[model samples]
Target: LPWHTTGKLSTNRVTSSCSRRAMPELLQFKDASSMRKYSRLQRQAGKRIALVPTMGYLHAGHMSLVQAATDRADIVIASIYVNPTQFSRNEDFGVYPKAREEDHRKLLAAGCAAVFEPASLYHPGTVSSDGAGDNANVVGAGEHVVGAHETFIQVEQLQKGLCGVSRPHFFRGVATIVAKLFNIVEPDVAVFGKKDYQQWRVICRMVRDLDFDVEVVGVATGREEDGMAMSSRNALLTPDNRQRAVCISQALKWAEEQISHREATPSGIQHEVTDRISTGGGRVDYVSVTDAENLQELKHFVSGQEVLVAVAAFFGSVRLIDNVVSVKQAG
Candidate 1:
């Protein structure tokens, strides 16, 4: 297995080299059985495993996650699968960017011990279709297919509001797939990015509530030099749209500043964020200020309690999300 170095990742706090040891040859697995077998073997050998689950099209943000995993575990395994259950029929799952070979090279350089590239984690033998196939199981709207993946995990209260409000099926797909990954990988630790703030909280809640034996680690959101959050979907942004996408981060920062200065209501901050993003040539999907831990939508800021200011907007057809956590101080 020849691993090519593709230069250093441009993510915040992430370097190309693994802190623990030299890069090892990356093992690739395409099916669940083989990946599970390997994980079992690693455990038998007394090696602690860490899992970083991702969709293909690796970027600096993903590399940051890999770096986090490498630091904590003896072996790091990154799973790349574009889950169909997460996206709605109107969403852009069909056009999601993918660079399998490039992703492998990047993960290898980032010190991932292996890459799990399962074609269909849910459907076993059949390939996942592009017609929102997971929706049938997620919402129970259509006739059940014989042997189709029917089981789904939902974090109920935590899945409400934020991205979950708009993309109703999104968290269901995320929680389910991540649970599947936890079982299959059986790693000592699992790493996730906080850029998807709600998703991170949802997974945390799922793990705690279900009592899974894996430690879930949430890494800080990796940003570009311009402060735009890194995401695979950024590949879909045209140059002009990409530039305008900065408003998402800008709005989040502004909200943080406002909350830190004085008492502010969630509605006022949401209005301002919505305005900023809309004026910056983007369509506002949602802007929410909620309790950081429970994700309950807050009416007013309280002293010393952290609140998450999150926004999702569309730059052209690409939807980008960003968030900032702020704690108000008592005057």
Candidate 2:
């Protein structure tokens, strides 16, 4: 296959034609069975495998995850499937953006061992009206596709708050699809972004409780020059909305400052963040301060308890989420 040379190397990193040899060949897989076959072969040969799950439309944030996988395993498999189960009906699932060509280029440039672009995995039967057609030969990644499968994985209590408040069914979709990926890929390790802090904790809990042998790694969130966490949805932001979106990170920074200064209580910090984001011309979804480990809602600041201050808001049509977590210590 043709490799992508268009991706620019980040500052402090050297790029040259010879460096490409250090990167593995970018193989493409369109179904679980084929990808699993390769995984089985790798396991038999005593090679370690690392998996990075993602919806297509790769960015620098995704490349960071891929890089983490490469550092840990002999082979890196990145799955690009836009799971319909994770998106609510009113959410923008249909138009979430699928740049397979560009994503392929980026993955190739990032030295991914294989790209699993399954049509649909969980939905096995004919396609449902959710846009997945009935003609799919095998089970693939398609929304609204009819399938006999009804089993879903959920991390009780954890999914009840935070981003889950607005999108109730979102985590169910995420947990179920992720379980499926872990089963099919059977990776020795998996990497996820901490931008979705709650989701990361949820996956970590699920892995531990389910007894999956795979190691779950949380890579730090990747941000743009302006401090906005990079996401596929960033493309949906209009020019002015994009500028206004910077307030999300700004509010986070302000909350961090308040924590450092010991000037604001948990609720006060939450209200201040809500006000700042709202005053910045964005609609607030939820501004919360909770225990980072258990996500229990915090009433007042408690020393030694790790607290997570997370925010989700709408900048125009785009819903943005960011968080800051730290151990509360006595000043």
Mind giving the per-residue lDDT tens digits that candidate 1 earns over 252-277?
88999988887678899999999999
lDDT of 2 by residue, 13-81 (tens): 123244656744567777677677778778888889999999978899999999999999988889998
What TM-score, computed on C-alpha atoms, does each candidate reach? 0.88, 0.88
Task: List ranges where model 1 is wrong by over 4 Å.
Answer: 1-23, 124-143
> Model-by-model lDDT, in order?
0.84, 0.81
**Poorly placed runs, candidate 2 (over 4 Å):** 1-24, 124-131, 134-147
